[model samples]
Target chain A: MKIAIDAMGGDHAPEEIVKGVEMARDRYPELEFMLFGTESEVKPLIQSMDRLELIPTTEVIAMGDEPVKAMKEKQDSSLVQAANAVKEGKADALFSAGNTGALLSSAIFIVGRIRGVERPALATAFPAFGGPHREFVFMDLGANAENKPSHLYQYGILGTFYAESVMGISNPRVRLLNNGGEEDKGDDVHKAAHQLMKNTDAFNFLGNVEAREIMEGTADVVVADGFSGNATLKAIEGTALTMMGQIKEAIKGSGIRGILGALMLKPALKAMKHKMDFQENGGAVVLGVKAPVVKTHGSAKANAVANSMGQIQTMVEGKLVDKTAEFIKENADKLKVKKAAK
Target chain B: MKIAIDAMGGDHAPEEIVKGVEMARDRYPELEFMLFGTESEVKPLIQSMDRLELIPTTEVIAMGDEPVKAMKEKQDSSLVQAANAVKEGKADALFSAGNTGALLSSAIFIVGRIRGVERPALATAFPAFGGPHREFVFMDLGANAENKPSHLYQYGILGTFYAESVMGISNPRVRLLNNGGEEDKGDDVHKAAHQLMKNTDAFNFLGNVEAREIMEGTADVVVADGFSGNATLKAIEGTALTMMGQIKEAIKGSGIRGILGALMLKPALKAMKHKMDFQENGGAVVLGVKAPVVKTHGSAKANAVANSMGQIQTMVEGKLVDKTAEFIKENADKLKVKKAAK
Candidate 1:
């Protein structure tokens, strides 16, 4: 199995990307990588030549560049070339730690969407609180600004398949993210989506789950329209950040005794932080694409990049994308958007 | 100023309600309260009825009961009677620590909507991370499931007036709660709302703010469609609860030294918790109503109940509801929904 890497992407760029690629190459016996970046920048960073093929590219997509515009203008950029490698079937999957918009663009427009899939969703795994499954997948993390009931239903199936095949959860329970946790509690779109999901025999349909109940691991997969999903996700992240920051301030403001107390409790706090760390789940998968495309964090180190590569390898080896494509293709009628009637 | 109090509501009803009413009556020299509840159950709890009047009500609206149905059927309920007092001009404002949905029903159908107001929004003040203003008001916290650009525009005006009149924030910044921070970042509804707010010479429109920036106090007033508002609010609350729970577990699971350290940090942690508590900001206001109607937490104690009454007193003394009604009525044309034309 082969994966195309956008070597010029991320904060660490060539050095960390090359090191991570080498780590994954040594780890996976049958895996190979085609690194796309400036030759001089990426060449010396590589520790081993074994199973690593460097494909030089002239242009680079900066973090601030407009996604669609950059993709069109920067034809020789590493992100573009890496996406092309997957499109041409030279590689089984694509991986990047670049700009999220650019990576998503590469996944959708370049690598292409699977036949019958309306829109690609960003699927990220998150830590769940005290359940059999310590983690759950949240889909459509701001991929599409607006979505029809059909797209939401499709996300239900896509997320379910991802959990079963990639995360190894059998018959994953799928829940629609709603404002209130009830059968008929939501806006027109969510209420319609709930009905659509309930009627289908595609996956294990759990009823609506509220944002508050998400961390409790009530559902293995939480599906939402991109706008609400993005807003809610940020709320959780922002709240957590604010609370932690305040705690730090409190500890500092409490003077010597409090500082000494915090010092002794470092291990416990570290453990909590480790559990909350989303990076341990690897990068987010731009699902519904023809091939597996994962986007790691921009500030990812060698270990994080290697872990993302491992996730990509699992997706490719399990043929998760192929399974999703075939399923969607077969159920195109059910997944078709019909909101105009509403 | 006279405020109608719903005595037979919340977890600690009658007892806490009466105590709080007495506290507020004592604190505010000219304040009088009409306590609505079953007289037999309420009168014994009142230590001194100097300015507090106990009005007998036969029925009660349980939290589990349907809001609209309860409002329609339970006419003699405390929540209904208190709201009726406000509507009949027997009381200057209304206060309830009851079922949010039921209180909202009373506020709308009984107290009535402010003229030209499209919808009544739930405005709750949350503790900001750190700023000149430690608290910021978030509006439309699940009052209307869906909202047009016009409703969103009105939320800006309503929320701004609220901050100025009640919270005492001079030239309060009003921001549209969106998924993205950019001016052109949201979906159709939000994009149009941004345009509407930007074009109008009504309030201080500070463009769009993502859910994450909310706690940072980027704006004094953050307005959103009810669905997004509810979801985001719950996410923030849920994440905080989860993190605190995890920290408690960590402290408990830690060895003797860690536990000792945590014990020493109690004062500091308490300060942090105090800062994070939303109850200090009083109850949520059902804005765009004829009178200042507020709903405190269901689990509110005497202190919290008194605090909310203080908020209501401020709103009443400032003629906030009347000011809001006049402003919205004057700007009816600008706030009219024309999305069908779009």
Candidate 2:
């Protein structure tokens, strides 16, 4: 299997992306990689032999550029070209750490979405505590503007499948993210989503799950609208950072107790930090596309890029395409019925 | 000053509430207290006191009980009676650790709204690290179901005055919460709110702020419609709690490194815990109302209740009512213009 990598994207750009490609190629000798970027920039970074190929491109999409406009105008850009390669079946998957919106639009416009998928979503698997712990998949991190009840139901389905196929979780417990833990907690959209999840036999639908419960590993698949999901993801990130900062400040405070405690708990704090770190997971997947499309953070480093590539390889080896196709085929009549009901 | 306490409205009910009232009465010699609950339940807890009085009734509102239904049918309920005390001018403010929805609706329906205030919002000042060490006031915590652009603008106005008066922050920075930092980041409502805020002269508008920026002390007032605001607040709370739990687990993990680190960082982690703890703030003020009302967490202890009562005293002494009135008078014409433009 061959995966296309956008070497001109992200903070580390050619350096990190190139390193990731070399690492993945080295680890998996049979796997092939198609690197897209300027030849000059890609040459020095390519240190390995065999399996790896270069698809040189002249244009680079800036992180600030309008996604739709950039996708449409930059015909020769690395992002669009990489996406086009997947659309044309030159590569099985496309990986990028560029502007998320640009990547999303390119995937939707160029690579095209899988049949029966209405809206694509960004799904992240956050690490959690307690038993049965590999964390849960939450969508859409930053995709659609407003999500209908059906969208949330679809997110639940996609998230569960992704968890099962990608993360190796069986019978993932899907949940609706609501303000309160009760059935009547959320507003109209949430209420509708809750009802749809309960009524549908598509997956294991856990009743309404609160934010606190999600943190405690209550659900394997958490579903919400794009606005709430994005806001929730960011809030969690900010809160974690804030806690880390506060922990640092408290350790630095000029006092005997502070110094004593800091000395005693240094290792414990490091353990805590490692557990909450998002870098270990590398990047999120823009699920529901026809082919695998991993959207790494724009500021991702070499390790994150490598992990993203590995994720794509793992998905490919696990036969995600076939599983998704089968799932869609099996749920076709029900999906159409759901559409009509909506 | 007189304050009404919902003696039977929390997990601890009359026991904690009575203890809080006793503490408040002892701390403030001249302050009058009226405790509301069923005579049979409250009499046992109501010990002899000079300044504290018990207004025993026959009704009680359960935690899971419907807010509007309880308010309408159980007129003599402790929560309703407490609100009635404020409405009858027998109390300066009302405090409840009960159903948030019940308090908000009862306050609006029975106590009445301030003139020119279209919808009274439930505002809470969230603790943050910044200059002068002030907390940002977020509005419509759980009041409105769906928020329009206009409601956001009003929430901004209310939050600004709340910070300025209660928190004593001059010229507080007001920000609208959005999915992205860009102008075109959100749906139509966010764009409209941005335009309105840019045009309004009454606020120190700071444009758009994403959820991740909140912990970095982005603004003194972050405004959003109730739905998003409530979801964001809960998400943050969930994230903080989750991180704290993870930190605890990490420190307790196997090996001497984890144990040593947990020991060293014990004091520091405690400090960090205190910083993120909502219990530290005591209670959240119900802003945009005619009079000051505070809602403590339903599971609050005596200390939280006492602190909330103290907050009421400080707000009253600070002339928060006059400040809110002055703000309404000043921004009346500008709000009219914005509405007209819409």
Candidate 3:
């Protein structure tokens, strides 16, 4: 399987990207990489070009650049070219650690969405600490500022497919992210979505799941409108970061006891951080697209990039996009239903 | 000043409720409490009758009872009667450590909304670490499953008054809790809310704030539509609880070193927990009501109950309801504007 790499993406850019490519290439013998970046800069960072082929390109999409505008203007940019490689069938999947908005734009507008998909959702298998499952798929994580109830219903389908095809979860249990655990909770959009999802024989519909229960592994796939999804994801992340920061402060302020405790608890703390790290689950997959379009955090190191490559390899091997397209085609009528319209 | 209390409405009920009342009664010589509950079950828990009066009631609103349904049927319930006391001007405020929904229902239906307020918000002063403030007020926390742009704008005013009158923060900075930090991020309602707030000369409007920044005290008061607010609040809470649980598990699984670390880190962990505890800041206030109506956790102990009393005292002393009413009267035209219609 071949993966198109936007080597000029991310804060670490060509250096980390090249190192990650090298790592992934060495680990998976069947995998090949088409690294896109400025030849002069990215060429020297390459350790071994055995399974890695450098497809040089100019222009870099900065983190702050407007997504759609940048994609339109930066035609020769590595991100755009890399996306084009997948669209042209030269690569099985597209991977980047660049500006999230830009990569999303490239994934949606460049490689394109699946036939019936109105919006391609950004899905990630976040860690589920206390639940039976180690991780569960959550989607529409800020892909769009707004989403219709029908879009949420679509996310359930997309998320279900991702979990089944990629994560190997059989009959993935899908649930709507609601204000309360009850069926009759949430706003008009969510209430309508609950009814829509509950009535469907599409996947394993397990009713509504609250934000407080997401980490508890209440369901295999949690669907949400983009706005709430974004807020929920960020809140969970922010809380974890803040608590850990507070612990660090407590240790520093505690003097001798804290120093000794820190040394003794180093392993436990290390394990916790590792579990919480995005690198553990690779990057987010922009599902409902024609091909696997993945993105790691911009600050992701070589390990994270390598993990993303492994994730992409699984998606490619499992034929997630193809399977999703087939499923959407089969559920054509359901996908087109406007029952959730206000 | 007099305060009505729902002594029968909690997991620990009359015992914890009476204990909390005694703590508050002893602390505040000028304050009076009107406790409503089953006389047999509650009379034994009372230590002092000075400044504490028990009003016997027959019905008990169960945790699972529907809010509005229970409110109408269980008229003589502790929660309902306490709310009624506030409504009839027999009590200055209403406090409960019971069914949040029931309390909110009673507050809205019985205590009533302040003159022109459309929806009352559940406002809580959650702790803020690594910032300029100890805690910042967050509103519309599941009070309404849906909130209009005008409601969000009203939260700004209500939250500002709570900060100023209750918490003594003057010219409090209010921000809209949005999907992104940018001024132009979020759904139609939030986008419209941003525009509405930005143009208003009524309050100190500080653009948009993401859920990630709430802990960092990006704003003194954060306004959000009820749905997003509920999601954000739960996400923050769930994350904290989950992380703490994970840390405990880590410590337990780490053996001798972990035990020693736990002992040394005891004080630091305690301090962190204290800072994060709801007891430290009291319960959520049902704002935009005719009078202060508060609800603490159902499992709250004596200390938490006492904290709520102190919070109620501040609200009453500051004349939060009267001041909010005055402000609403001044900004009547702004409050009634429905610019966020889809």
Task: Using DockQ, give the best candidate's number.
Answer: 3
lDDT of 3 by residue, A1-342 (tens): 999999999999889989988988888888999999999999989877798899889899999898899999999999999999999999999999998999999999989989988889898998887656788999889999877778888888899888988888898889898898788888778888888888788878999988988888889999988888999999998998898998999999999999999899989888888787754569999998899999998898898899889999999989888888998898787765654352
Order by TM-score, highest first: 3, 2, 1
Q: Model 1, range B169-199, lDDT digits (tens) per residue? A: 9889888999777777778999988988887
* Clashing residue pairs for model 2: A261-B264, A264-B263, A264-B264, A265-B261, A265-B263, A265-B264, A265-B265, A267-B261, A268-B261
DockQ of 2: 0.62
TM-score of chain A of each: 0.95, 0.95, 0.97
Q: Single out the weakest 10-residue window by summed lDDT for candidate 2 chain A.
A: A254-263
Work out the TM-score per prediction. Answer: 0.95, 0.96, 0.97
lDDT of 2 by residue, B1-342 (tens): 888888888898888988887887777776788888888888887667678788988888888888899899999999899899999999988889998888888888888887677778887778776545557777667688677777788878888877887888889999888998877878787888888888788889988988887766778888877777777888888878877777677656746756765666666677677767766466877777778888899888887888788888888887787787777877688878777655
- What CAPRI grade goes to candidate 1? high
Query: Which candidate comes out best when scored by TM-score?
Result: 3
Q: Model 1, stretches more than 4 Å misplaced?
A: A330-342, B329-342
Q: What lDDT tens digits, residue by residue, belong to model 2 across residues A35-60?
A: 99988888887887578888899999
What value of lDDT does candidate 1 attain over all alpha carbons? 0.88
When summed lDDT is taken over every stretch of 10 residues in candidate 1 chain A, the lowest stretch is: A333-342
